[model samples]
Target: MSHHTLPRPGASVFVYEWPVRLWHWANALFILVLIVSGWFIARPLPTMQIGEATHQFVMGYIRFAHFAAGQLLTVGFLGRIYWAFVGNHHARQAFYLPLWQKSWWRDVLHEARWYAFLESRPGIHVGHNPLAQIAMFLFMVVGMTFMIVTGFALYAEGAQRGSLPDQLFGWLHDALGNSQLMHSLHHLGMYFVVIFMTAHIYLAIREDIMSRQTMVSTMINGYRSFKDDDAA
Candidate 1:
């Protein structure tokens, strides 16, 4: 379709909803807190003795915060997942899989061309950009899977051998060589999430600066104003 055929600014696009926006920013905050606390828990300072009361106190607080943030994260994730099926057409399809290889390739080239400065304007997108869509879906899967596995591993460490968490993580433990391996996988998953978060923030800022659009405000107000002639 020609760019001119696309909806113009003030075309009455109903993009985001308040609940989705709330869930997004809330989840972002929880994830950030979890990442920081998790790092300290994983590697304590050399000067801090592990068996000391002070060390225990710090570790205990970290564990508490991590679990609390985890609960909030799970709630936000489930809400967004539910919205994916029931939300507006744009939200439902924003991060959906590309069914046509031709369209996918076209979008890929368009993205590359834009990035390379070969295109003078951004591409028109009713939903997420092709790359954002793929990254969102992948991150959802990876994040959810990591949370489940890591949660079970942590639970198993405290529960009886025949308890639910222990039983659930047993096969995973065997396959990965033990709980230690599961911990490593969980930690590595954080790196992926960190990378995604960094890129997401950078792109949002870049778009806001270049386009004079409130990329961050969209998450707060559930609306992003764009020129009808704007590429996206």
Candidate 2:
């Protein structure tokens, strides 16, 4: 997922570093928790009359996990943004798009063709391909910011005015005007994240099967080994 196809000969290259690998896994786990708990909160399970009021807190625990995961996601994201500045060039790929470059857009189209089965081979690069870069920029970066802001804004309501969440995210209420709309948008954001995650996993698997380099394993161990000598 990180290294380029060999420019010269056969050997593995280290691409993702420890921080990136660690954050990738942690962020993924946090997102999973958020989605699962968020859904239950939105459409709660049926109440059990068999239990006394003091004996159970099923919904309460679900809401707590949702809130906890949201906080973790926010913190992890902020640290990731910091890594974009301090980490390797590959680490910064998701933070911005190369919209001004014509060749970049051409390669993006090439990637599209590769996915569509129109191209015989996909190109390999040191970092993300152009298409993946743009998708990450828009979906992960921008979409994530949207989710974090709206989520905290909703949390701020429960925290009451003048609390830290309110002070930090209160502007979202001013911009959106209605709490229900914010809730709806946050719910929609979950679907967007799920869609992206599905596509990301599929593309990783497809590339692992078709490409010259290690795809999924590269993220896990921070190195990418080429499977072919053909120039990517």
Model 2: weakest 10-residue lDDT segment is 1-10
- For model 2, the superposed segments whose C-alpha errors exceed 4 Å read 1-6
Taking the tens digit of each residue's C-alpha lDDT, what string does model 2 give over 40-67? Answer: 9999988777589898899889999999
The ten-residue window of minimal lDDT in model 1 covers: 1-10
Query: Per-residue lDDT for 70-91 in model 1, tens only?
Result: 7678777777778878887656
**Clash pairs of candidate 1?**
8-228, 9-228
TM-score of 1: 0.83
Predicted model with the maximum TM-score: 2
- TM-scores across all candidates? 0.83, 0.94
Choose the strongest candidate by lDDT: 2
